[model samples]
Target: MPGPVSNDQFFARVGELLEENKKAGHGSVFFTQKRLTPSNVQNAEDKDPLWDVNLPGPFAVLIRATNGKSKENRDDKIKVSTVVQPESSEEFFKQYADVCKAGMQALKPKDRSKRKKKKAKKRKGPVDGEKKP
Candidate 1:
């Protein structure tokens, strides 16, 4: 989770994911947008992704959780994206790490100085050779 990410996008992805999972039976997820949309964005699904991992060309890495419904074993998953899914898990992790790192670098500290730029300065004595107020 990055600081300044879109709340709408986050919720949208989660909603689409749950919808896909619902459609795929027990615990599965499916793509909801075109295999390839310009800008890699779409109405609901493509705008955000669960795990980009490695999406070379018209591809994305979606996951399907298929574990015995229990509290302690929910991380189990199946790679669902196929168009350009990573060939190896190593690649998946690598891409995730990359996205996280980029997000971290993109964050910036908020500066209040910019918003409070109009500080009143004292008025100078009436002007050239004029009497003081």
Candidate 2:
């Protein structure tokens, strides 16, 4: 008899695939667990490995470009799409690395100073409120 596949194994497989697509020059990639459908929930007792816990059926991954562009401008920009599928650990990792690389490229850090300025402004008392003596 075959041993049951562990949850870690399943998650790792998905992560690996996303990473590969990122490295291949895609903008970004992410993995999410498949949700139970209304039909599945209605019929559920114990979790169904085929339909509930595993990767589920087909899904799409959207990778935005690194350059920040308005929605209209971005429409013309190239984006990457990944299709999820059953894959061995090794193959999955390859794909995951690619996706991760693209994600890294697309990520942009927020301006910390802008946030600090907003917080400081909020902390100020109203005009003619109280004065430090």
Candidate 3:
């Protein structure tokens, strides 16, 4: 997919999230310009050369769940990505909004304990394993 043309358009989508009703869940909608390399430049530049070359803009949306169903489980999140194109921007947004709303319902609170890394147990005596009382 392509991406939203202007910040206004992009923000318009973001604004929808403020209502706690976008990004396919209780999270945020992120816009990331598509990756560009020397080879891909040719096609991307076709639309706007200077823009594609210098600006290198956002062409996709990242929908991630933030804090839903519980406050402590903020880490539990659902991520959904979509592309934006001139032809499908509106449709994509509509689909994303619906997705956010639908997915949010089934979102399970993250288990904070699982996310925590287990610290290694300290050596009882010494690193060389020397016997000591």
TM-score of each: 0.20, 0.27, 0.26
Q: Please give the lDDT score at residue 1 for candidate 3.
A: 30
Q: Which stretches of candidate 3 lie over 4 Å from their true place?
A: 1-38, 42-82, 106-133
What digit string (tens of lDDT, one per residue) describes model 1 on residues 1-133?
A: 2232232343344454555555555563332323433464434546566544444454443332222334555454322222224344456456534533443332466777755553322234235336643
Top-lDDT structure, candidate number: 3
RMSD for all candidates, in order, please. 16.9, 13.0, 14.1
Q: Can you give the lDDT of residue 67 in candidate 3? A: 26
Q: Which lDDT tens digits does candidate 3 get at residues 19-101?
A: 45434444443434443244454565556766554645544443332223345654543222333554556776676566445
lDDT per residue as tens, model 2, 1-133: 2232343454444455445555666534333333224343444445664554454543323222223234787753332223334444356556556645544544676669998888777777553255653
Best-to-worst TM-score order: 2, 3, 1
Candidate 2 Cα lDDT to native = 0.45
Q: Pick the candidate with the highest TM-score.
A: 2
Give the clashing pairs for model 1: none
Q: Report the Cα lDDT for residue 86, model 2.
A: 44
Model 1's lDDT to the true fold? 0.40
After superposing all C-alphas onto the true structure, candidate 1 shows an RMSD in angstroms of: 16.9
Query: In model 3, which range of ten residues has the least summed lDDT?
Result: 61-70
